[model samples]
Target: MPTDTQILAAIDAAFGDSPRPEHFTHYRHCCECAEHDELLRHRDRETLQHADVGNAGWDPICFCSPEGIAYYFPALARFALAEPVPELDWYGWQMVFHLDYGGAENPFFQHCAPQQRQAVAGLLAHLLETRTGLLEMDADSALRAHGVWAG
Candidate 1:
């Protein structure tokens, strides 16, 4: 897997220089986002403690809050492992996509056009592929390379 720094860099690159302030605010708190300042503080944890605050049926484990979903889905979609993508089951995914593409519930929608939304989706898909490739490697070596595991 990419190091947390690498992941955050990727997210920043994906969002580019023109990210809206509201989007940046939401992204900073999203659990799935490595750029989330809170995540950086809890780097030793294997997973998020309360990821599903906004989930409808199943409880999520990270930033599962509505805001989390709205801000993180694009990034998460890139790393989803299951075929057809797991976000399909989460209402937050739809909401985020709609908002990013043109839906008005979020102020970020004011800054994003369909093209930018599509670009974000594509970048997220690439990040997911990179995450999957990293997962396919042996854990010990991968973790060592990222300097995230000592054991």
Candidate 2:
């Protein structure tokens, strides 16, 4: 199995060094990724105290909220915001961050690692219940933007 170091190095080699892939993994089957996934989840809940952070983030634990989304917007939307998403599942949101941070065009969507996919799942697990109305999620990726961000 790939060590966490190797996996992270791969991500850095591929995605660069600003937002380190510390909390996420691009490799799915990696046991290390699965382990990290669980760890990040625990960290997420602990950090938020399982509450909706209207504009909260950036402590030892970083989570997505209405506030964080703006920070990540448009930079890596191509992969995350693609139309015809089959489901508003894990990968859907994972693509929102931890990808090649640029825009809809520059990113090589195909290059996303498995751990990155897992990251989306963790993000959604934390925010879905807390957020409301803006994300109209169907059974699948038929995600629709119903309204603007609600305060």
Best by TM-score: 1
Residues 1-151 of candidate 1: C-alpha lDDT, one tens digit per residue: 4444454455445444432223322445445453443442342122433232224333332322334333443344332322333444433233233333323443443444555444444444433345445344333333322221111
Among these predictions, the greatest lDDT belongs to 1
Tens-digit per-residue lDDT, 1-151, candidate 2: 3433343343334334234233343326566545534544444311432122111232211333222232232223322222333333333334323222332232322233444433333333323432323234431221211110110
Which residue pairs collide in model 1, if any? Answer: 51-61, 51-62, 51-64, 52-60, 54-64, 78-128, 79-128
- The per-candidate count of clashes, in order, stands at 7, 12
Query: For every candidate structure, what is the RMSD over all alpha carbons to the true structure, in angstroms?
Result: 13.8, 15.6
| lDDT: worst 10-residue window of model 2 | 142-151
Residue 76, model 1, lDDT: 46
Off by over 4 Å in 2: 1-109, 137-139, 142-151
TM-score of each prediction: 0.29, 0.24
